[model samples]
Target: MAIEVNGKTIETDEEGYLINLAEWNEDIAKILAAEDELSITDNHWEVIKFLRDYYDEYQIAPAVRVLTKAIGKKLGPEKGNSKYLYELFPYGPAKQACRYAGLPKPTGCV
Candidate 1:
């Protein structure tokens, strides 16, 4: 599948993750979040940016458990827990946030 962002046709997987990580941008992220019925706020951007940075360093998308722990370390405990993360990305923090960050589906996510 594909999504149009800023007049460019960007490709995505059937599940909506970007086909080319290089094609990701803020506009595309907004579109992806809209598809999931989410409105990106500063709090949401924090998670998305964090996910992107994590993928950059690790070369992998983290699962929910790993994501929570890492987030707690980097962002703090209050923002790192499942409840807080879920409040930001209700579909599933690692999966949904990674999608918005234009990373692949987190390993082990169904």
Candidate 2:
């Protein structure tokens, strides 16, 4: 599938994850929010930005446990807990959130 944003096209896999991670930015985030049926809020954006930065720095997409732990360290305990993370991305924080963040699937997810 392809996601069109302001006349530019981004390719996605059958599951809606961006095929090319290089073609991502805040604009792509907006398109992903729409594709995922989410209303982009400050909190949601925070998580998305964090995911992108984490990928850039670590070169790996974190699993749910790692994500929660790391996010808790950076954001706060309340924001980084599994319950909170799951509330934000019910399909699995590492999976769904990474997809929206235009990142590759986290290793060991399946």
- Where does candidate 2 have its weakest 10-residue lDDT segment? 31-40
For model 2, the superposed segments whose C-alpha errors exceed 4 Å read none
Question: In order, how many clashes per candidate?
Answer: 0, 0
34-85 per-residue lDDT for model 2 (tens digits): 7678767788889988999999999999988899999999999999898988
Candidate 1 C-alpha lDDT tens digits along 1-110: 99999898999999999999998899998998898788899999998999999999999999999999999999899998999999999999998999999999998899
- TM-score for each predicted model, relative to the true structure: 0.97, 0.91
**Candidate 2 overall Cα lDDT vs. reference?**
0.87
The TM-score obtained by model 2 is 0.91
